[model samples]
Target: RHDKLAVNYMAMVKLAMIQQHLRAISPSDRT
Candidate 1:
């Protein structure tokens, strides 16, 4: 459904944002 696609997109965006935040918080320690 269209709603399901939208939810998936949002989840991906949130994940990307979290990753960026983590990178900014720690640039040396990567795992």
Candidate 2:
């Protein structure tokens, strides 16, 4: 159970990082 929770937490962190990266890049492209 503990391992599963850790894996889920890591996945969430990775997703957040990817989202932030995309948001950062998209604004520059718009202008």
Candidate 3:
């Protein structure tokens, strides 16, 4: 159970990073 939670946390962090990267490349292409 703890491992599952950790995996979810990491996934969210990665997703946030990707979003930030995309915004940096195109500030006007936000959804």
Candidate 4:
């Protein structure tokens, strides 16, 4: 049970990181 929770947390963290990276990159292309 604990392992499953850890995996889920890691997946969420990676997803958030990817989203943040996309947001960080998009503004530079506008200029």
* Distance from true location, Cα of 12 in model 2, Å: 0.3
Which number leads on TM-score?
Answer: 1
Alpha-carbon lDDT of model 1: 0.94
Clash count, one per candidate: 0, 0, 0, 0
Candidate 1 lDDT over 1-31, as tens digits, reads: 6999999999999999999999999998666
Per residue, candidate 2 scores C-alpha lDDT tens digits across 1-31 of: 6999999999999999998999897877666
By summed lDDT, which 10 consecutive residues of candidate 2 come out lowest? Answer: 22-31
TM-score of 1: 0.81
Q: Give the TM-score comparing model 3 with the true structure, all chains together.
A: 0.77
Q: Per-residue lDDT tens digits of candidate 4, residues 1-31?
A: 6999999999999999998899897877656
Worst 10-residue lDDT window for candidate 4 reads: 22-31
Model 3 agreement with the true structure over 1-31: per-residue lDDT tens digits: 6999999999999999999999999989856
lDDT of 4 at 22: 94
RMSD of each: 2.0, 2.6, 2.2, 2.9
TM-score for model 2? 0.76
* Distance from true location, Cα of 9 in model 2, Å: 0.3
Local distance difference test values of all predictions, in order: 0.94, 0.91, 0.94, 0.91
TM-score of each: 0.81, 0.76, 0.77, 0.75
Between which residue pairs do clashes occur in model 3?
A: none
